[model samples]
Target: SQQGEEDPQALSIQEGENATMNCSYKTSINNLQWYRQNSGRGLVHLILIRSNEREKHSGRLRVTLDTSKKSSSLLITASRAADTASYFCATDVRARVTETSGSRLTFGEGTQLTVNP
Candidate 1:
């Protein structure tokens, strides 16, 4: 099965605010990565946390994982207008060569985040 599914497919916030989103998965994975994509732009890697870890942070981003529950959350603090983008969680699992691209990522549909300045 696919690894992650995020809730609240859309969100809106004012500048200098905080935004939080949750993701749930249904299988064991090697790692999970988050990515952001702005309108008409390519996706940018945000953060990645391995299954053995529980939490990780980068810049204004905070991510937490609960392996037991197969869930994860991303927190963006002191947001800015530039933060407006679509967020997606992708899972990485071990795959054999026949699996195609050899990338084990199964991406979610994504959460559209709009930050107003």
Candidate 2:
């Protein structure tokens, strides 16, 4: 499968600590995106890194992509209790040579993070 697989299926940390999660995927991809889900809520996009992008940052979130290794990592700096959520990595692969609408995203199993106050 072309879906991504996240490492460290679960994490527990106190408030103000940093949380790091890693994801690895099979097959070539057009882009990789990170998302966060709070308990029963739907996923919210955190960052999107194209195949050409090595790294990107948004607020306290940092995402890194290594196409050569087919892997990606997400770092949450100084996490708060509100940062508790499940993080997932999704991959967008090229569907076919003639398709132009973009392929559907395949999501990883996700990493559950618990930030205790």
Candidate 3:
């Protein structure tokens, strides 16, 4: 319920073009993160954009967050076949009163990306 939901659950694209994915959540959040996971593997953290930040960049990846709309988007430019993976958006809900000290990341169903050569 509190987890973020991503759009375009499946995507197939050429190697050189860009790939875009969107995520939306229902509650206030401390931070939002993007992750990439290969088939049968653990997730690799890509970017962490805080609530105060509207946009962020890391290498060929760009992320934009809009707190007013409770939404975020990730863009991968000049994609390669190696970039193919399932991307997940994780959010830390600020409204939650938890005794746990560590981060409580809520992940969505993810958008599966396949970059063709």
Candidate 4:
């Protein structure tokens, strides 16, 4: 079963505004990661939060996790037109005790953010 499903399929905001996105998942995970993708480009890793961590920040971005609720959120401050892009949340699920290959990652559907200048 895949985990990490994002909420709010899309969002629109003006420059300097803030953007927030949420994701929910099923099953236990080792970590959660966020990624951003510009139009016609590949995804770029933004941040990663371990299952034990509750919050993290990087530059204009803030991420929060609530393991009790199996959810996470990403907030981008002072949004710019250049910030318009799609954001996704990914989960690294813990492998079975017998499995040795490695962990598996499941990605969310993604939230499309449009920041108007």
Candidate 5:
């Protein structure tokens, strides 16, 4: 996988606690996006931070990107039971493509977060 494993394959926390997950990739990227998937549901787009960005926040989500390290982190603040889901970090790397190739988002192994009420 172009994307390396995410830290903490699973996390269990009580409601209101923050959940943090980290993702690392092997190559330079154009941008990185975070997604969430509820049980038996499709992935939901969360936040997309660009390679030039250091950090960004949306709602209760905070994302950080370090292009020098080829790594990114997702922080879900003030978590709730409704926020329990699998979170994935996806990286778009145009550098891997050839003239006939297309850019794609490579997803890392997701982190399953369980927020107990």
Candidate 6:
């Protein structure tokens, strides 16, 4: 598949600890993004990093990319109970010659993250 796949479809962490997740893809991409979804809310965009960028950080969240291995990782430091949610990695792949320039993301099943108090 040309989509990104995240491992360990679930994770649990303490209120003041860290949580880490990994994603792997099969095709070249223009960019990748991480999003979070609360139990009953819309997905929230966390961060986006281009294929050329190696790393990016937002607040307590950190992301790393390795094009050579077609993989990426997300780390949340000092995770809080409020951080409990499902996380998804999305990628904008290169469109086909006959296709348009825009590329829609194919989401993984997602990781259900729970932060305990």
Highest TM-score scorer: 3
TM values, all candidates:
0.89, 0.93, 0.94, 0.92, 0.90, 0.91
Candidate 1 vs candidate 2, TM-score winner: 2
For every candidate, C-alpha RMSD to the true structure in Å: 2.6, 1.6, 1.6, 2.0, 2.2, 2.2
Tens digit of per-residue lDDT, candidate 4, span 6-97: 88899999999999999999988888999999999999999999999999999999999999999999999999999999999999867742
Q: What is the lDDT of residue 30 in candidate 5?
A: 80
lDDT of 3 at 72: 99
Estimate, for each residue in 30-90, the C-alpha lDDT of model 5 and write its tens digit.
8889999999999999999988899999999999988898888999899999999999988
Worst 10 residues of 2 by lDDT: 93-102
Q: What C-alpha lDDT values do all the predictions have? A: 0.88, 0.92, 0.95, 0.92, 0.89, 0.88
Cα lDDT of model 1 by residue, 1-45, tens digit: 446898779999999999998888887877889999999889899
Ranking by TM-score: 3, 2, 4, 6, 5, 1
Worst 10 residues of 1 by lDDT: 93-102
lDDT of 6 by residue, 64-94 (tens): 9999998998999999999999999988757
Return the lDDT, model 2, position 102: 62
Error of 1 at 61 (Å): 0.4
**10 residues in a row with least lDDT, candidate 6:** 93-102
Residue 95 displacement in candidate 4 (angstroms):
1.7
CA displacement after TM-score superposition, residue 101 of candidate 2 (Å): 1.6
Model 1, position 104: C-alpha lDDT score: 58
Clashing pairs in 5: none
